[model samples]
Target chain A: MRAFVLATAAAAIALGAATTPAQAGATLDAVKARGEVVCGVNTSLYGFSYPDDKGVWRGLDVDTCRAVAAALFGNAQKARFVPLSAQARFTALQSGEIDMLPRNTTWTLTRDTANGLNFAPTTYYDGQGFLVAKKLGVKSAKELSGATVCVQTGTTTELNLADYFRANKLDLKPVTIEKYEEVTAAYLAGRCDALTSDISQLASIRANDTPNPADHVILPEVISKEPLAPAVRHGDDQWYDIVVWSIFATMQGEEFGLTSANVDQALNSSDPNIKRFLGVTPGLGAALGVDEKWAYNIIKQVGNYGEIFDRNVGKDSKLQMARGLNAEWTKGGLMYSPPFR
Target chain B: MPTVRWYNNRRVRGVLYQIIVLGGVVALAAYLVDNTLHNLERRSIATGFDFLGREAGFGISETLIDYSPADTYFHALLVGLFNTLKVSIIGIVLATVLGTIAGIARLSRNWLVAQFATFYVETLRNIPVLLQLFFWYALITEALPVPREALNPLPGVFLSARGMRFPEPVWGATHVAMLVALIVGIVAAVILARWARRRQERTGQIFPTGASATALILGLPAIAYIAGGAPTALDMPELRGFNFTGGVVVTPEFAALLIGLVLYTGTFIAEIVRGGILAVSHGQTEAGLALGLSRGLVTRLIVLPQALRVIIPPLTSQYLNLTKNSSLAVAIGFPDLVSVANTAINQTGQAVEGVAIIMAVYLTISLSISAFMNWYNQRIALKGGR
Candidate 1:
C-alpha cells in the first residue's frame, strides 16, 4: 500500500508538469526551417480573421500573417492559419503551437506583463462598444441598466463589460459564450438585449452576421480602450524583433507612399529613408536576420497597411469601417512607426 | 546464504521490484518538474495558486450565491461549483424517476407502452449528449419570443428566449419560521414511521404509516403557516425594462442543459433498471402470486428489494457520468465549472493551476458519490441468506 501511494504521487507530479522552451530566435528559426509561418487567429471574426467563400483566409489579421511569411520566405502563400477561440489564443502562442497570435486580441497590461506576451504596435485601434437591436427603443448604454448582455468569453471585452456595469451600478446579466459566432447568434436570437465586443467586431457582426444590419445599432459609447494588436511569446527577442519589423514594414510602406501597384517604382527613389526601409540598402534586413528585400516582398505581396485595411474592413469591404483612429500618424491617428534607421 | 538467498526469497524479491519501480517513477517525476520549472522561469509566466485571491473581472449569467465582479476568483469558482451541483443533483433524481418508469413500462403487457419505451431507449442513447445539448439550446433560443412579447401562458409567468420567469413568495420572517416548522414535521413523521414499524413487528397488525405520516408532515407545516398570520405577500415578476424582474428565473441555458443531460443519461439508466428487474427470477413473482399477493404488492415488496442489489452499482456510474457531463455546460454558455475555469485560465494565464482546481473539484465530487453509492449497495446486499 505504501509503495502504491508513492507511485501514484510520483505519477501525479509527472502528469502535472507542462513544459515549453521559448529560447531567443527559436520561432524565427522554426518558421524559416518549415518554410511557412503558422499564425493563430480568430476562428471567424468578419474583418479580423475569417475564411472567404473560397475557404481562403481574408482579413487584416490574415494579411499580417502573410506579411510575416513574405518577410521570412518571400512568399505570401507560405503563411498558414490556425483558427483559435479567444480562450485558446494565448495558450496556443505560449505553447509554441503557433509562431504568433494575430487574432483580434487587445493589448492589455496583464497580458503584456503577467501573460508573457509581447505586443506589436496596434494594428487596429478599437474600443469596447455595445450593439443593440433598434426595436428596443434604447438609444444609449446608460438606458441598458437592467439588460442582459451577450459577450465572448476569454476576451478583454468580458472583463470590460463587468467593469462597466459595476462602475455604472447597473444590474447586468452577461451571457458569455466561448465562440464568437455563438455570442452574436445569441444576441440575434434575442437571448440578450445587446451584444458587447470591440467596435470593429461589432461593425463586422452587424454587416455580416445579422439578418438585417439596419435593425441593430452600434451604440455611440466606447466603454474601454481596446488597442487590438498582434502578439508573440516572450523569451525570443530576435523572433519578436522580426515580427515587430514585419508589421512596421507594412505601415512604413504606407508612410513612404508605397502600394502594391507603385512599390516597384518607389524602389528606384533616391530618398534614403524609403530606400533603407524597402531594403534597397542591406543593413535593415541583416539587422533583423532576413533577406535584403524582405520589406519589399511584404509590400509587393501583402500591400501596405492602408491597402490591407481598406480592402478588408474599410470602404472597399462589406464592413465599410472608416479609418478613424487607424489612419497614419500624420493624419492624426495612432498608426505610427519609428524611423527605419 | 546457501540456506536462504534474498533473490530466491519471494517476499524480498517482490519488495525489491516495487522499490525499483517506485524509484524510477520518482526520478521521472523529478526530471519533469525540473524541466517545467526551468522553462516556466524562462517564459516569465506567473505560477502558483495566488491568482485565486485576485479579483475575477468577469460576469456569470447564472449564480446561486451572492457574487459580483468585485468577488475573488475563488468566489467565482464557488458559484460555478454550485451551478454544477444544482444541475447534476436535479438531473440525477429526474433521470432516475423517468428511467425506472420507462424500464417498467417496457416490460408492461400494453404493446403501445412497451414499444414507446423501446423507441425512446434505442433513439436517445445512440446520439451523443453534446449534440443533443446544442440542439436543445438552438430550439430554446430560436423558438422562444423576446421578453417584450413573451408567451404568457399563466397569470404571473412569462416564457421567452431569455428564460422562464415566475412569481415567488416574498421571503420574510414568516417564511423562515415555516421552513423550520417543515423540518420539524419531517422529523416527527420519521419517528412515527419507526414506531409504526416496531408495532407491526410486535403484533401482526399493519399501521397506516403512509397516510398518518403524510398527515403529520403536511399538517404541522399548515399549522405553522396559519399561526404565522398567513402573510400571503408574493413577489410577482413584472416586465421591467429589458426582462422580467423580482421573481425566480429558470434561464434557457440551464433548462436546455438539464433536458439534454436527463434525456441522454436516462436511456442508459433505463437499460440498467430493465436489467436489474430481469435479474430477479420469474419464480419469485410466481411464489408471491401463489401466496395470494397482488401484482403491485409483489413488485413493491418482493421483486424491488432484490432488484435493488443489481440496480445500485451501475446506477452509481451513471450518476458520476451525469455529473462529469454537466461540465459540457460550456458549450451552451451555462457557466458551469469548466466554463468558469476556462475564463480564469485565460485571464490569469495560469493554465496549470486552473486545470488543477477543476480536476480536484470533479475528483472530490465523483469520489463522494461513489462512497455513498457503495454504502447504499452494501445495505441492499443479501446478508448470508438471513
Candidate 2:
C-alpha cells in the first residue's frame, strides 16, 4: 500500500513536471514567441463555445480567448481553441496543456485558490436553473418533489441539484452522466423528468440541441449564483494581469459605448476616457507588458463583451438569452471594470 | 589459492546487477515523487485523503446503501464500490450460467441450437463492450416509453425509461430468520453430499444424495418461513407522477450495465467452456457409451466434472475482466468507483488521492476474485494440489 501510494504520488508529480520542462514566468513571453495562444474551450456548448459549420470556433467563451490573443499579438485568430470537458478543463490548464481556459468555468473560492487557478472577472453571470418538458406543467423547482433529473456529472450543477432536492425534501432520482449530450438525450427521451444545468446552458441546449425547442421551458427558480469566468494558472502575475485586463477591456469598451463596427471611429474621439481606453494615449497596455494599442486591437478584432454575448447567445443567436446579470454596472448588472489609466 | 577469473565470478556479477536495477528503480520513483510534489505545490492542488470526510454534495443515480447529499466522501465511495460490486457479482453469476448453457448447446445435435450459439458468440464478442454498453443504455433511455405509458410486460413488473421496477419481498424478522435457515440448510446439504458419496463408494449402492440435499435445502427454508407467519407478500410498484414508487427498481443505468456486461462477457466464457469441453477426449464419451452407460448418466457423472478443470482458469479471468471492465460505467453514468472518484477529484481538486483510491479499490476487487478462484480451483483440480 505504501509503495502504491508513493508510486501514484510520483506519477502525479511526473505528469505535472513533464508538461513544464523549462517554461517559466508570465507565460506571455512563451505565448508571444510561439505565435499562437492555446486557449481551452468547451467542445460542444451551443452558445458558449462550439465550432460552426465552417469548423471555425465561435461563441462567448471562444471570443474571450480571441480577445486575449488580440491583446497580445493584435490578431484574434492567433488564439487556438482546444475543446475540453468539465473534468479536463482544470487539469489541462494546470498541466500547461493550454495557456488560458475561457470555458464558461464558474469562479468559486475553491476553484480560485485550491485548484491553483486564477479566475478573471466574471465574464457571464449565470445561475442554476431547470428545464422541464412543457407537458409536465412544472412552473418552478418547488413542485419537482418526485422528479427524476438528468444531470451532467463532474460539475457543480450536480451538487446544486442535490442541494435543491434535499433542501426541499424532494425524493429525487438523478441520472448523472458524463457529457452534455447524454444528459440532453436522456431528458429528451423522458428518461428524466427534468434537466438541470446552468441557466445559460439550459437555454442553449433547449434552443439549439433539442428536437422540439418549444416543448421545454426553463423553471422560474434560480437556485444558485454561478458567476462564470475565464481562468488561467496561478503564478505568472504578468500573464494573469493580461488575461484579466483582456476581459476588462471588453467590459470597459461596452461601458464607454464601443462596438467593433465603430471602434476605428472612436480612435479619433476627443473624449479623454475613450482615448485612454483605446490607447490613443498609451499607458495601460505597456504597464501590463503589451503593446500600447492592446485594447484597441481587442476592440478592433473581437468586439466588446456585449457584442460577443449578443452575437453568440443573445437575441441574434438561437439561444436568445437576455443580457440579464451579464450587463454593465451602469445597466444594473455586475460587470464592473477597473480604471484603465 | 587458484586465481578466480572475473568472468567466472557469478556471485559478484549477480550482486552488481541487482544493485544496478534496484538503484534505477529507486531513482525513477524518487524523480516521480519529487516532480509530482513540486508540480502539486506549484499548482496548489491538495494531495491527500483528508477530503474523504468532507460532504459529497453530488447525487448518485443508483445507490445500494442509504445515501444523501449530506453523506461524507468516504460514505459516497463505499456506496460506489458496493454498486460496482453489486453489478459485477450479479453479472459474473449470470454470465457463467448463460455461458455454460450456450457452450453445451454449441455441441448439441440440433443445427439451429449450434448455429444460434455461434451467432451469439460471434455477434456479442466482436462489438466493443463500451459500444454495447452505450447501445443498451440508449435503448433503455430512448426506446423505452415514458413512465406514464410504462410497459407492463409481466405481472408486477414495470418497464419504463425511469427504470425496470418489479415486485420484491419486503424484508422482516421472519424473512431474516428464514434466510439464516436457508444458509444452514445449504451447509447441511454439502455435508450430506460428502457423506453420501463416501457411503456410495463403500457400500456399492447409490445414496440418492441429490434429491435428499435439495429437499433439505428447500424444505428447511420453507418450514422456517411458514413458522415465521408465512410472510410471502411482495411490495409492488405503483405509478407516482413520473416514476414507479415502492418497488425494487433496476435503474436504467444498472440494467444497461448489467445486460451489457453479462452479454459481452458471456460470449468469451462460452468460447472458454466450448474449448474446455473439447479438451476432454472424445473417446472418453465413446468409452462410456460402449460400456452401456446411459448418455445422461455418462455426461452428469463424466464430462462436466472433467471439463470444469479445463474451464476454471480462463473462466476466472473472464470474471475478473467483467468486474474491472465495469469501470466503463463511468462512460454511461453509473456511479461506479471510477466515476465517483472522478467526481470527487473534480470537486476536491485532489486528483492524485482520487486516482489512488480508485486504483486501490479495483486492485482489491481483482485480487479478491483471483484469490477466491485459486482456492476453488485447488479444491476441484483433477490431480491432488496440481
Candidate 3:
C-alpha cells in the first residue's frame, strides 16, 4: 500500500516537471505561491557573496536576491540562499533549481545572450587583474611574463588569464584549482608565482585573507571588463522585470540620497519622482504584480545600493572599493537608471 | 466463455507482471527524455556537439600532449582524459605491486612486518582520499624551499615549492638499436622457455629457465649498449633564474595526486589480495610441501595460481575504482577529465553536453577494462573442477 502511494506521488511530480514550459508568467505565480524566492549565490566570494562569522549571508550579491524577495513579500529574509560555485551556478539557475542566481557573475555577451538567461542591471563593475607578492617588486603586468599564475578552475578568471596572456603573446603557466579556497591556499603556499581574478576579488583577498595585508599588492593592469550582475532564466518577462526594477530601485535610491534609515522621510516628500518611487502612485508595483510599496519594502528591509555596498563591499568594508565606474550618471560615472516618474 | 484453469491463470499473471515491468521502464525513459527536451527548448539552450570545436580559451596546468589555450574544447578534454589515464595506469601498477607485497607481509612470520602491514592498511583506508591528498599536497608545497633558494637534493635534482626537478634523458642514435635489442631479447627468451619446457617434460629435469631468460634480456641489452657506443646522456637540471627550466619537473599537484591515489588504492587492494590468498585451501600448500618442495615452491606452484583466480575479479573492480577516483584530481588542481569538463561547462554553458561527454569517456574506460579482465579471468578459471 505504501509502495502504491509512493509511485503515485512520484508520477505526479514527474508529470508536473515535464510540463513546465515557457508559459510567460509561470515563475511569477510560482514565486507568489511559494511565498519565497530561491536565490543561488557564490559559496564564498568575499564582499560579493559569503557568509559572515555568525553564518548570516551578507553581500552586495546577497542583497540583490534579498531585494527581489523584499519587493515580492515585503521581507528581505524571504529569499533563501543556495551557495553555488562558478561551475554549478548556471545549471542551478537554468535547471530551475533556484529561482535566481545573484552570485558575483560577470555579465558577458555569451552568458547574457547565448546562455538561457537574462542578466539584470550591473550590481558592481569589475575587471580582471593580478595580485602578486610585494616582495616580487613587480609594479605592473608588463614586467611579468612567463609567470606561473593561480586561478580558480571554473571561473571566468581562468579563461581571462589565457586571453590576457595570448593577447599579449606572453607564455604563462596557470595553476588552476577547483575551489576558491584552494586557489587561495595554493597562492599562499607559493605553488604559483601569482594569483589572478577579478580586481574586486584581488582587493578582498589582499585585504582580508593575508596576515600582512601590505605584503601583497594587486597589480594596476585591469585586463578585462567584468560587469557583475544578477541573472534569471529567460522566458519569464514579468519575473525578469521585477528583478531588474528591484535592482534599479536600489540604484534609484542611491541617486535620490534616500537610504534605508530615511525612507520614511522620503515617503512624505513632495518631489513627484520620490512620490512615485515611494508608491504614492501604485501603477509601477501593480505592473510588476506586487504590492504598491515594492520599492519601499526593498529599501526598508534591504538597504539601497549605496547602503548595501558600504555595509558589505565598499567604503565601510574590508574590500573598500571606490565606486568609480559604478558612480551615478550625474556624478559623471556610468550608472544610469531608467526614470521612475 | 470457457473457464481458465488455475495453472493457466498463473501464466496470465506472469505475462502481466512482465508487461507491467517493461511498461514502467519505457514510461520512465520517455518521461525523462520528454522533460529534458522540454526544458532545453523552453530555455532556448542549444543542444548538440557544435560547441566541441570552439576554442576552449582555457589553460591546463599539466599537459601530456602539446596543448595551448588556443586548443578546442575537444582537445582540452582529450588532454584531461590522457592525464587521468596516465595517473590511473601508473597508480594501478604501483598499487598492485605494493599491495601484493603488503598482503604477503601481513601473513609473514615476522611480527614486526605483520604489524607494520596491518598498521598501514588500517590507518590509510580509514582516512578520506581528499584529506590525504590535501595533507600530501600541503606537506610538499609548504615544506619545500622557495624557488629562489631551491634545495639541491642531488647533483641533478632540485626540490622547491614549485615542483621537483630531475635530470632528463637525451637520447641519441643508439636508442633505436637499444629498442631493437629489447625486442630481440624478449623473442629469444620466449622461444627458449618453450624449448626448455619440452625438454623438461621428456627428461624430467628442470632447466634454470628464469635465470637464463633474465640473462638473455638484460645481457643482450647490455651488449647492444656497448655495441652502439652507449649514446645516452643526462641533461642535468640547474637553476637558471627562478626555477630549473630544462628538466623533467613533477608538479606538486601531479605528485600529490599520484601518491594519494596509489597509497589509498593500495590499502584496498591489500585487503582484496589478503582475502584472495586466504581463500586458497591450506591442504593444497601442505600437499606441495609434503612432496619435498620448498615453502616458496608451495606458494608459487600450488597456492598462487588458485589465489589469482579469486583475486582477478575483485582486482578489476579496484582498477576501475582507481580510475573513477582520479576525478578527485580536481580538488587538488590536477587537470583530469572532471576538472576540465567543469571548466568547459562553465565557459560554454553547455552543461548537458559537457556532462554527457564526461560520462561517456568514463563509461568507455570502465567497459574496456572490464572486457580485458573478463578475458583474462576466463583464461585462468579452472577448466574442470576436481
Candidate 4:
C-alpha cells in the first residue's frame, strides 16, 4: 500500500513539473510561427464587442483585435475571437486561453502590476456616470441622496459609485444586480432610481432604451477616470511592444490621413513620415521583432483608429456616441501616438 | 484446508483492491496540483493562499454585514456568505408556503383551481432560473416610474423604479412585550398539541386540535397587544421632493432575487408535493370514510400520514437544491458569495484562494442540509419493515 501511494505521488509530481513552464514565455513566439493571433473580447457589449446578424463579430474592440492579427498575419480574418465575461477575462489571459484582451477592460494599477498583466496604449478614455428617468426631475447625481442605484457586479463601477457618493457626502443606497442586462432591467423596471456605469455604456443603453429614449437623461457626473486598454499577460516584453505599437500605428496612420480606402493610393507617397509609418521604409517593425510592413498591413486590412471607431460607435452606428476624450491629441483629445520615427 | 485458503485469499484480495483505489486517487490529485503550480509559475503568476489577507479594493451592492473596499478578501467573503444565507433562508420559507398551497390546489375538486396550479408549475419549471432572474431584475422592475412619479400603493407604501418603500415601526417597550407574548403562544400551542394527542389515545374521543392551537397562537398575541399598549402608530413613507423621506426600503436587488428564487423553486416543490400525495393509496381514504370519518378527517387522519413519508425525502432535496441555486445570483450581480468572491478574485488576482473559499462554503452548506434531513427522515421513518 505504501509503495503504491509513493509511486502515484511521484508520477503526479513529474507531470506537474514537465508542463508548467513549457509554454509560459513562448506564447508570442508560438503565435508568430502559427501566423495568427487569438484575441479575447467582450461577449455582449454593444459598440464594444457584439456580433452582427451574419454572426460576424464587429465592434470598436473587435477592430483592435483584428488590427493586431493584421499586423502579425497580414490577414485580419486570421485572428480567432474568444468571448469572455468580466469574471473570466483575466484568468483566460493568464492561462494563455487568449493572446490579447480587447474587452474594454479598465487599466487599473492592480491589473497592470499585481495581476501579472500589462496593458497597451489606452484605446478609450471613459468615466462612470448615471442614467436616470427625467421624470425624477434630477439634473445632477448630487441630488440623488438616499436613492437606490443599480450597478453591475464585478466591475470598477462598484468602487466608483462608492467614491462618488462618499465624495459628494450623499447617503445613496446601491442595489447591485449581477449582469449588465440585469442592471438595465432593474433600471427600466423602476426598481432602481438610477443605473450607474461608464459614460459610453450610458450612451449605448440610452440608444437601446425601449419606448422614447428621450424620456431618460444621463446625469452630468463623470466620476472616476476609466482608461480602457487592451491587455496581455506579463513576462513577454516582445508581445507587449507588439500590441502597443499596433495601437500606436493605427493612431499614427490616422494622423497621416491614411485610411484603408486610401492606403493603396498613398503607398507611393514621398513624405518620409508616411513612408516610415506604412513600412515603405524598414527598421521600425524590425525593432519590435516584426516585419517592416506591419503598419501598412494594419491600415490596409483593418483601417485606422478613426475609421474603426466611427464604424462601430460613432454617428453611423446604433450607439451614436461622439468622439470626446477618444479624439486625437492635435484634435484636442487624449489619444496621442509616440513619435513613429 | 481449502476453506481456510479461500478465506485468506478473499482478505488479501480486499486489501489489495483498497490499496490500488487509494493509490490511484492520490496520484491523480497530486498530478493536478503539480500541473497547476507549474503552469502558474511558468506564467509568472504567484500560486498561494496568502492573497486572502490582501485588501479587496471593490465594494458590493447589497451586503448584510458591513464591508468596504478597504476590507480584506476574507471579510468580503464573509459578507458574500451572509447574503447567500439570507436569500436562501427567505426563499425556502416562502417556497414552502407557496408550494403547499399550490400542491393542495392541484388535488382540489374545482377544475379552475387545479388548472391554475398546473399552469403555474408548467410555466415556471419550463423557463431557466437565470432568464427568470433577468426578467424580474430588468424588464419588470425597470418599467416602473421614477420616484417622484411613483404610484402610491397605500398611504405608507410607494412603488417606483427604486424599489418598494413601506413604513417601519419604531419599537418601544410595548412592542417588545407583544413580541414575547407571540413566542410564548407558540410554546403553549406545542404543549397543547401533545396533550390533545394523549387525550385522544386515552379516551375514545377527539378534540379540534387544529382550531384550538390556532386560537391559542393568535389569541395570546392579541391579548398581549391590548395589554402592552394597543395604539401602535405606523411611520409611513412620505414622498419628499424627488424621493421618499422616511421608510424602510427593500432594495430592488433583494426583491428581484427573492421573487425569482421563490417562483422558480416553488414550482419544483409543488410537483414534489403532488407526487407525494398521489403516492398515498386511495384505499386509505376509503377506509377512513368507512369508519364514519368526515372528508377532512380522512385526509388529515389517514392519507396525510402516509403521504408525509414519501414527501419529506424529496422536499429536503428541493430545499438543498434551492440553496445551491442561490449562487446563480452572480448572473444578475446579486452580491451573493460567488459574486463577491468573483470581484475579490479579479481585483486581487487571488483566483486560487477565492475559488477555494467559495467551494468550501457551498460544500459545508450542502453537508449541513443533508445531515439535518437525514436526522428528520429517521425520526419520521416507518420502523422495522421491508
Candidate 5:
C-alpha cells in the first residue's frame, strides 16, 4: 500500500516535469509577452551593476540591459536586474531564469560553447590585475611573489592567478572566497597580502569599498585578457541579434557624436549614417524584428557608450577610471561597430 | 476461477498494486533521466566524468595533501576530500570530548559548572551555524595582527591573521623508525590488554592494564628514539617576502571553520549525552553506590553502560551532522570538498557531474560513519533481550 502511494507521488512529479516547456528560440516572444527583459548582473559590483541608495539598479552593465529593453519595448524601465554571484551567473542563464547575462561575465571558449552560452559582443575589455596595500612598497606584479592573494571563486581571475603564478614561477596562496564583499574583507583585514581581480573591479573596490582609497595601488602588469561580454543562451538567434545590435547602437551613437541630450535633435539631422543608424531609414529595425525607433529609444534612454562609461565608472564617477581600451576606434581603442548600411 | 472476484482477494490486490507502483516509479525515473540528458545535450554542456582527468588550474588555500595548480582535477578533488576528512574527523573527536565533559557538568552538583554548561548549550544551539562561522572568521581576521608584527605568544609559535605558525620537527630516518616502533607498541599493548583481561577472568587477581599499556606504547617509541640518536632538528618558520616560509601554518580559515563546527555540534551532542545519562534510572546508580562503589565508579560502571544503548544511536546522527556541516567551510574560504567541487563546476561548466561527485562523497562518508556506529551499538546492546 505504501509502495502504491509512493509511486503515485513519483508519477505526479514526472507529469509536472514533463509539463515544463523545453526552451528553444522563443526568448524574444517570451520577453514580449512578459513585458520585461530579465538580466542577470553582479550582486554588488560597484560600477558594473549595483543598486543605488534608492534601490534603483545603475551601472554600465545595468545600462546595457536598459538599452536592450529600450530596443525591444521602446521603454528602458521594462528591464529588471537579478543580482547573481560569480558561481551562479552562468547557471542562471542556462536555466532560463534570466533572459540575458551582463554580469561582468568573461567571454571564453568553454562558456561560449560548452556552457551553451552565446556571447553578444565585448562590452567591457578587462584584464586580470592585482591590488595591494601601498604600505607593502610593491610597485610591480613581480614583487608579489609568495603573497597570499584574496580572490573571488568561479571567475577567470582565479584561473589567471594560478596561470600567472605558475608561469612566473612564484609561490602564491589564494584565499578564494565566494562573495565579492567577503573576498575584499579578507584582503582588508590582512588575511591576504593582496587582492586579485580585473583592473576595473580593482578600481571600483579601491574607490568605493576601501576606507582609504589612497592606501591601495593597482599593479602595472596585466596578466590575462578578460573580454567581458553580455551573454544569452544558445539557440536564440533573434534574441541574440537584438542584444548585439542594442549594444552596437550605443557605440554607433558615440561614433556619430550622439548623446542622450543631443539624440532627439539628431532626428532632423541630414547625415545619412546617423539617419540610417537611428532607424530614420526603416530597414535596420525591421531586420532585427523591432520597431523602427528602436535605436533611437536606446540612445535616448541609456545614452551613447561614452556617456554611459563617463557617468558610471569613468571620470564623472568616484572611480575616475580611464577609458583606456574602451575608447572609440578613431581614438585608438577597440570600440567599433559595423556600418549601418 | 474463485468464488469471489479477483479484485476482492487480498493477495491479488496486493500484487496488482505493487506491480502498478513499480511500473510507475520505473517510468518516472526513466523519463526524468532521459529528459535531463536531452536538455544537457541540447544546451551543449559536455557530460561525463572526463573533466576529472583534465588539469585543474586553480589553487586551494589550505590543502592537507600536496597540490599544485598543475595537478589534475582528480588529484585536486582528492586533496579536497582529504581536507574535508581532516576537518570532519578532528571536529568529531573534539566535539565528542567537549560534549561529554559539558554533559556531565550539566548534571553537576556545583551550581557554577551546571550554569556554565547550560549557558554554552543555549548560546551555541540558538544561533545559526553559518552565522557563528562568519563571526569566528571575522573575529580571527579582524582581531589578529598582521604577519610582520605577529604576536609571539609562545616560543617559536607566532599568531597572526595569516595563520598560527609553529615549528615542526624535521622528518628523518629517526622519525620513520619511531613511527614503526609506535605501531609495534600499539599492537603489543592491545595483545597485553587481552591477555590481562583473560587472566583477570580466570584468576581473582586484578591487573593494572591501563598503566601497563601506556608504558608499553610510550616506552617502545622512547627507546627507539634514544637508540636512533634523537636527532631534534626543527624547521622554524621565518618571516619571508609576504608570509612565513617554513613550518606548519594553521590558516585562519581552517581554524575558524574547525572552531565553529566543533562548538555548534558540541551543543547538540551535549544535550544528547545529558538525555542519555538521565534516561538511565536512578536505581542503578543507587545500587552501585550501595555496593561500595564511588560516585564516579557508579556512574561509569552501572549507569553509562546502560546509557550506551540510548547514546550511541543519537551520537551517530551528530557525527553525520558534523561531517555534513563541514561543507559550510566553503563560506569561510576553507576549501573543503564542496568548495573545491564548486570551483570545478564553475571552471569545467560540468555542474551535473560536479554535483554528483559531491553527493557520492558525502553519501559514502555518512554511510560509513553510520555503519561503524551501528556495529558499536550492536556490541554494547543487551544480549537475548529485545
Candidate 6:
C-alpha cells in the first residue's frame, strides 16, 4: 500500500512537469510589467563591472546592461545591477534571479548549446595571454620553459596555458589559484614566473599595478579565442532578439556617428538609416514589443559603443586598454553589426 | 474500559503517523523531481548524466593527476577532486599544529606570549577569509623583488617574486637507508611507550617516558645515519641567468592559502584550548601541588588530561571547519576541488552532474572527518562511567 501511494505520487509529478511549458515568456512579461530590468554584473572587475565612489556600478559590462534597459524601457536608469561572482553568475541566470547577465563572461560552444543559455552577440574580442615582469628579460612566451605560471583555477586561462605549453613542448609548471586577486598576488610576489589570463585582464592588471605599470609587459602570444558576450537564458526567441538587436543598435549608432551628445541632432537629420535607427520612422518598435524609438533611446540614454568603452576601459580610464580587436570592422577590427533594416 | 482501549491503540497510531509522514515526504520529493524533468523537457534541455563522458576541452591550472584539454569531463572532475583533497589534507595538518601551539600559548604565564596569541586569533577571526587571501596574494606576494635581485637567505635557498626556491635533494641508496631507520625508530618509540605505561601501572613509580621515547626515536635515526655513511646530500637551488634553475619551488598561491588557513583557524583553536583548560577545576591543580608535585608535573599529570577531554570535541569541529573553509581557495584562484569542479562545469556544461559530484566528494570528506573524530573521542572518553 505504501509502495503504491509513492508510485502514484511520482507519476502525478512527472505528468505535471511534462505538461508545464519551460518558456521564459512569463518571466519576460513580468519584467516588462515591473518596468525595470535586473542585470547581473561582476562585483569587482575594474574595467568590466565595479562600483564607483557613489556606489553606482560602472564598467563596460555595466554599460551593456544599461543599454539593454534603455532599449526596453527608453530609460537607461531602469536597471537593477546584481553583483555576482563567477561561481554564482550562471545559477542566477538559470533561476531567473536576474533578467540578464552582462558580466564579462566568455562565450563558448558548451555555454550556448548545453547550458540552456543564449549568447546575444560578441561584445568584446579577447584572447588568452600571459603577463610577466619586464626585469626577467624574457622577450617572449617561448622563453617560459619550466616556469611556474600563476593562473586562476576555473577560468579558460588555465586550459589555454596547458594547451600553449604542451604545443610548445615546454616543461611548464602551472600554480593554479582560485581567485583573480590570488593570481595577481602570486605573480606580483615573484612566486610564479608569469601570470596568465585574458589579454584584457592583463591590461587591467597592469594598469592597476603600483609604482610603474610599464614594469610588467603583456606577451604578444594570443592563445585561445575568448569572445565575451551578454547572455540570457534560452527558450525565449523574442527576448533573445531584443538583446541581440540592442547590442547591434550600439554598433549601428557608432557607425552612424550618433554620440549621446549629438543623438538629438542625428535624430533631426534627413538620412534614411539614421531616421530608421532613431525610430523617426515607426513600426520597428512594435515588432519587438518596444517603442519605435528604441534605438534612439539606447543611443541617447546609454551612449554609443565608443563612449561606453572609453568611459570604462579606454586610454583615458585607469585600465588604459587599447581598442585593438574591439574596434569597428571597417577599421580592421571585429566589431560589426547586421543592417538594422 | 475506554482508558484501557486508548492505551492499547496508542502504539498502532504512532506507527501509522510515522508511515503517513514518511509517505508525504516521499510524495513531495517525487513531485519536485517530476516538475524538474518536465521543465527540462519543455525547455528541450537534455537531462542525463551522460554528459560526464563528453570531451572537456578546458585545461586545469594545477592538477596532481595527468589531465589535458583532450581529457574527458569525468577525468577533469577527478583531477579536481584530487586537488581539493591535496589542499584540504595539507591545510588540516598545518592548521592543527599551528592551532595547538597558539592554544597553549594563550594560557602561558608570560603576558607577551598570551597577548600575541590572543591578537592573532582576534584579528584573523574578524576579517573575511577571501579578503585575507587577496591581501596575502596581491600585497605580499607581488611586492617581492625580482629573480635577479632575489633574496638568498642561505646557500641554495632563493626567494624572489616568482616563489621560494629551495634545494632539490637527489636521493639514492643512503636516503633509502635513512628512511628505513626513521621507521625503525618510530617502532622502537611505540614499544618503549608501552613498556613505560606497564612499568607505571605495576610499580607506581614514574619512568622518564618523554626522555626515553625521544632517545629511542632520535638515537636510532642518528645511529642509522652514521652507519649508512650519511647518504643524503643537499642539491641546493642555483640562481642562473635570470631565475632559479633547479630546486623544489613552493608557489606563492600555496603559501598564501596555507598561511591564511592556519592563521584563521588557529584563532578559534586557541579559544577552544583556553576554555578547555579553564574548565578543569583549580582544585585539581592545587591537589597536585599539595601532593608535592612540581608545576610542570602537575600540568602534565592532572590539567592536560582533563582539559583535553573538553578540548577534543570542539577541536574536531575546528578541524572540519578549516577543511571546508579551504574551498575558499576558489576566491584566491587555488586549484582546489571546488575551483576545479567549477572549471569542469563551465567547460562541460554538465552543471547538474558536476555539482552532484562536488557535493558527494565534500559529503564524503565531512563524514570521514566526523567518523575519525568520533572514534578518537570514544577512545579517549572517561572509561568505567565513574
Can you give the TM-score per candidate against the true fold? Answer: 0.95, 0.94, 0.94, 0.89, 0.96, 0.87
CAPRI class of candidate 3: medium
Q: Which structure among the candidates has the greatest lDDT?
A: 5
Q: Write the per-residue lDDT of candidate 4 for residues A1-341, one digit (tens) a residue.
A: 45457656766676656565556468788898877888898877888888888989888899998888888777889888888877788989987889999998999987877677899999888898999888777899899887778787667888788777877777767766555765686677676778899888888888875467899999997887999899998888888888999999899889888999999988799998888888888878888877788899999988898988898888889888888988888899988999998
lDDT of each: 0.91, 0.88, 0.87, 0.82, 0.92, 0.80
Better of 1 and 5 by TM-score: 5
Clashes of 6: 22
Each candidate's iRMS in angstroms? Answer: 4.7, 6.3, 3.6, 3.7, 3.0, 4.6
How does residue A247 of candidate 4 score in lDDT?
Answer: 95
Most accurate candidate by DockQ: 5
Ordering by lDDT: 5, 1, 2, 3, 4, 6
Off by over 4 Å in 3: A1-24, B1-20, B240-242
Model 6 per-residue lDDT tens digits across residues A176-254? 6555665676677676778888888888888875357889898888888999899998787788888889998999899
| Residue-wise C-alpha lDDT for candidate 6, range B1-386, written one tens digit per residue | 44655425778667766776676677667766777776655554556778678777665656788977778877877887787777678877877788888888988999999899888988898998877877786654657777778888888888776678888768777667778878988898889889888998999978888888888778877887788786557777777654577768776666777788878887888788889889999999999999999999899879988888898898888888887888887766667777777877665555676778888888899889989989988887789857
RMSD of each: 3.2, 4.1, 3.2, 3.5, 2.5, 4.0
Name model 2 segments beyond 4 Å from true: A1-23, B5-8, B384-386
**How does residue A267 of candidate 3 score in lDDT?**
89
Candidate 4 is scored at a TM of: 0.89
Query: What are the per-model numbers of colliding residue pairs?
Result: 0, 1, 0, 18, 0, 22
Query: Which candidate model has the greater lDDT, 4 or 6?
Result: 4
Q: What does the lDDT read for residue A226 in candidate 5?
A: 92
What is the DockQ score of candidate 5, to 2 decimals?
Answer: 0.59
Q: TM-score of chain B, per candidate?
A: 0.96, 0.94, 0.93, 0.91, 0.96, 0.90
Question: Which whole-number lDDT from 0 to 100 does residue A285 have in model 4?
Answer: 85
Which sections of candidate 4 miss by over 4 Å?
A: A1-22, A29-35, A208-214, A269-276, A313-327, A330-333, A339-341, B2-8, B44-63, B66-73, B195-209, B291-295
Please give, for residues B250-314, the per-residue lDDT of candidate 5 as tens digits: 99999999999999999999999999999998988888988998997787668988998999999
Deviation in angstroms for B104 in model 2?
2.2
Better of 1 and 6 by DockQ: 1
